[model samples]
Target chain A: EADIYQTPRYLVIGTGKKITLECSQTMGHDKMYWYQQDPGMELHLIHYSYGVNSTEKGDLSSESTVSRIRTEHFPLTLESARPSHTSQYLCASSAMDRNTEAFFGQGTRLTVV
Target chain B: AQSVAQPEDQVNVAEGNPLTVKCTYSVSGNPYLFWYVQYPNRGLQFLLKYITGDNLVKGSYGFEAEFNKSQTSFHLKKPSALVSDSALYFCAVRAKAAGNKLTFGGGTRVLVKP
Candidate 1:
């Protein structure tokens, strides 16, 4: 199993609320990513961090922002939540400089009520 | 841009029978392909990956994938189906141009009958 962990496996909140998804890894990987997946849909890359102090937007445009202050932590924050933001957010990590296996944490299933 | 495609959205196979999940990809340069399986309400588990060299690669739980350069396809195959294998399977690829950020397909639901 992956050493990565995501807090609040399930979350239900009202619209327009500020929230954050926690993603932590113990493997000290340089590459971390966030993918948003709707039911029976493709997983779209939302955000990623190459290392501490480095973040980049992914293929899919998202309103969320991410921070990588530590090597093991890459947290995504939403300035304002909407119903459309509800989906499974998966966190994954992989070693950089080579093609390595990616480890994934149990996704956080968010619901906007 | 690099992309992967899973032709079958869902595949059902009889228990003990062989099964295959199709995947095709397009990349500008060298391709790194991977397969992952997800059970209900669980995290995705790495099944296998094809980086270079050998066309056929084996992975965890007796899963294997064959990389075909001419076809630009990497199809996952299992000699026998298991009920436990029922889950969503995703085909992912990372193009040389895009670094190692993986792009996933829509995924395929594999159901094995008893």
Candidate 2:
């Protein structure tokens, strides 16, 4: 099993509340990503980081922002949560080499009401 | 940009039967293909990947994928399906020309009935 972990395996909160979904990996991977997924649906990349201090927005437009202060930590923050923001967020990481496969976390299922 | 497609939304199969999941990809240069499986309320687990070499690559859980360069297809297969094989399967593609950014398909739900 991969050493990556996502906090709050499941979360339910009221709208307008600020929330941060934590993702950390112990494998010292250089590439980390955050993907949004609906139940039994496709995965949409929202944020990714090549390494510490290097972050980029993914193909999808997301209200959330992410930071990579530490190589093992890539946390995503939403300024104000909304019902629309409710979804399963997955965290993944991979080695620097392009040929390697990525390891994923258990994912965090968030619900905003 | 690199992209992947899984035409089927779901694939139904009976246990102990052969299984196949179709996947096609589009990329600017050589393609890197991958297959991942996800159980309910869990993250995706890597099943296999095709970077180079043989067209047929075997992976975990008796899963395998065949890469057809001419068709731009990488289809996953399993000789004998099991009830535990029921899950969501995703096909992804990445290209060196596209900065190696991985792109995933819409996903295919596999239901292996016993």
Candidate 3:
């Protein structure tokens, strides 16, 4: 089984609340990524980090920010959640090598009311 | 920029029948392709990847993919799909020189009937 875990499997909150989604992997992977996906839809890459202190925005623009202070932990924070920001957030990790496939967490589904 | 495409939005097949999902990608230089499966409200699970070597790569759950470098395609297939295999499948691509970010295609929903 994949060791990656995302906390708060489901979250429902008010529009203006601040929220942080936690992602951690026991696999000690160097590359971590956060993707936004609607149910049964395409996945849009929002944020990814090559290693500690290295984060880059993905193909799609996103309002949330991510920090990779630790190799095993990559957290995404939304300053002020809005209804538009509600979606399924997936966290994945992969080794430094390009040949390896990424492992995903169970995902965090957020709903802003 | 690297991108992937899944032509079919949905594919239906009877149980114990052959299954195929089409995928095509574009990338500068060589490409690293991958296939992932998602079951309902869950995160994507890695199915398989084609980095190099053989054109046919086998992965989890009796799934396999064929990489056609000339056509820039990696299509997933199963000899006999089961009802439990029904799910959403995604195709992704990463270029060798494009860092480690993966570009995913629009998913394809697969339905297997018993």
Candidate 4:
């Protein structure tokens, strides 16, 4: 039983191609986050949204953009994919409470050739 | 800046043995601590958290964590290690002033060999 879902669990695309990674949660959480991780490495925050139409850049610099049009959906898009964009993208959501922990979705592994 | 530290990159333990994964954190005020486990190619699963309560917090899969305020540590422990317990563990921390953002430590891979 997965509360959060990510589409195209694995993806391979050519350079300059635009790709959108979809993440949807059924938990009705208000806060969502995007993290990028390489193999056997730490996860880096890239983007986050507190609610619909409220998005902010995270600690890491990313060419990808995200949109939160609905409470349950937060999708990340790479405007122009490059070789460096190859990595795993993870999505997480948490409750409005400050003490609550965030729940993560099975990541999307992207490879830009 | 709120940060979490998992000093050991890998921890090896034999089955039926007590296991511990160490974690320490730094934050301005009282800290909200959490532990998550990640299996191969899977998203992280929350194991336990320490918002405020007893120092010993129990969580899923027979895991427990001890929150030490003076030492600023929350170490995950299991009474007996199992081969199935082999996975990557992450420590996270968040301060009240940091909004909802959680800063994560570099993961520690735990290998429980039979």
Candidate 5:
């Protein structure tokens, strides 16, 4: 089935650790996005990519960086993870049309102590 | 800027009762609206959308939403609530010309009580 996938569904690490959250889609979508969500809070868009090698910061400023090396892969990296980085990270991909529905990956929950 | 709003922080409904999740939008032009549901520890799932041509849109899991242009709203509704329906619901909007960048609401947590 064509789906978006995220690796390491759950992660826990000490502060000052570097980590990468993997996100890949098999849907051949042109738009990819990363959102952060704390329990019981609204999702905040942190990054998005329109296509390969194109990345942009989203509404909420984030300390992480994302790269779109390929159409199917948009991975996010945090140089130094902190307790504040503990949240659920959601990955989504959509077609080029504004009205089209986007597909989402299961999500990665990262915890930094 | 195009945006959607879910004013309620949470809503409580008894099982087998009707349920509503309110959503409103603000856009410069005709709006493309959508509703998504997220269960605990899960990614968002597309529920329904309102693009054009129709006022009522049906979606997965026996849920539906009505688009009201005059009110600038697209509220999610279900005929009967199930405990499984307890989840976070979000309303999203995109400008007609703005391609594929969705602005989402704060989200509403729907609780279906027994």
Candidate 6:
């Protein structure tokens, strides 16, 4: 089984609320990524981290910010959630080896009302 | 720009029948292609990938894919389908000229009827 885990399998909150999605991996991977997906839609990369203290925004624009304070943790935070932000958030991690496949978490489904 | 395209939005097949999900790609250099499956309310799981070597590559869950350089396509195939195989499949590509970032297709939903 994949070691990556995402907390709050489902969440529903009103607009303007602050929220955080947690992601952690025990695989000792250096690369971590966050992706957003609407139901039945393709996943869009939102944020990624190369290692502890290193983060980068992905191709898609997102209001959420992520922090990589430790190798095992990469959490995404939304300062103010909105209805448009409601979606499924997925977390993944992979070894630095080129061509290696990534392991993914079950995902967190967020609904901002 | 590097991109991956899964032309079909959905595919249906009866159990025990063969199945194929089409995918085509465009990249500046040699493509690193991958296939992933996502069950309802879950994240994507890696099914297979074609990095190099032979055009045919076998992967997890009795799945296989063929890489056709001439066609610039990588299509997922299964000899016999199972009802439990129903899920959402995604095709992704990363160009050698590009970085490690992967560009994913819209996705294809597979429905296997018993």
The TM-scores of all predictions, comma-separated, are 0.98, 0.99, 0.98, 0.98, 0.96, 0.97
- A1-103 per-residue lDDT for model 5 (tens digits): 2399999899999999999999999989989999998677688889999999999999899999999989999999999999989999999999988879888
Candidate 3 achieves a global lDDT of 0.94
lDDT of 3 at B107: 94
Model 6 chain A scores worst on lDDT over the 10 consecutive residues at: A94-103
Cα lDDT tens digits, model 4, A1-113, are 45999998999999999999999999999999999986876989999999999999998999999999999999999989999999999999999887999999999999999
- Candidate number with greatest TM-score: 2
Off by over 4 Å in 3: none
Better of 3 and 4 by DockQ: 4
Model 2, first chain, TM-score of 0.98
Highest-lDDT candidate = 2
- The Cα error of candidate 4 at residue B83, in Å, is 0.2
lDDT accuracy of residue A84 in candidate 6: 96
Please provide, for model 1 over A1-113, each residue's C-alpha lDDT reduced to its tens digit, 9 standing for 90 to 100: 78999988999999999999999999989999999988766799999888999999999999999999999999999888999999999999999954687899999998988
What are the RMSD figures for all models against the true structure? 0.9, 0.7, 0.9, 0.9, 1.3, 1.1
Cα error of candidate 4 at position A109, Å: 0.5
| Worst lDDT 10-window in candidate 3 chain A | A37-46
For candidate 3, give the lDDT of residue B96.
Answer: 74
Q: Which residue pairs collide, candidate 1?
A: none
Candidate 4 RMSD computed on C-alpha atoms after optimal superposition onto the true structure: 0.9
* Stretches > 4 Å off in candidate 4: none
Query: What tens digits encode model 2's per-residue C-alpha lDDT throughout B64-113?
Result: 99999999999999999999999999999988998888899999999999
| Each model's fraction of native contacts | 0.74, 0.87, 0.84, 0.82, 0.87, 0.68
Every candidate's DockQ is 0.75, 0.91, 0.84, 0.85, 0.79, 0.73
* TM-scores for chain A over all candidates: 0.97, 0.98, 0.98, 0.97, 0.97, 0.98
- In model 3, which residue pairs have backbone atoms overlapping below 3 Å? none
| Candidate 5 clashes between residue pairs 3 or more apart in a chain or in different chains | none
- The C-alpha interface RMSD of every prediction is 1.4, 0.6, 1.0, 0.9, 1.3, 1.2
Residue-level lDDT for A66 in candidate 2: 98
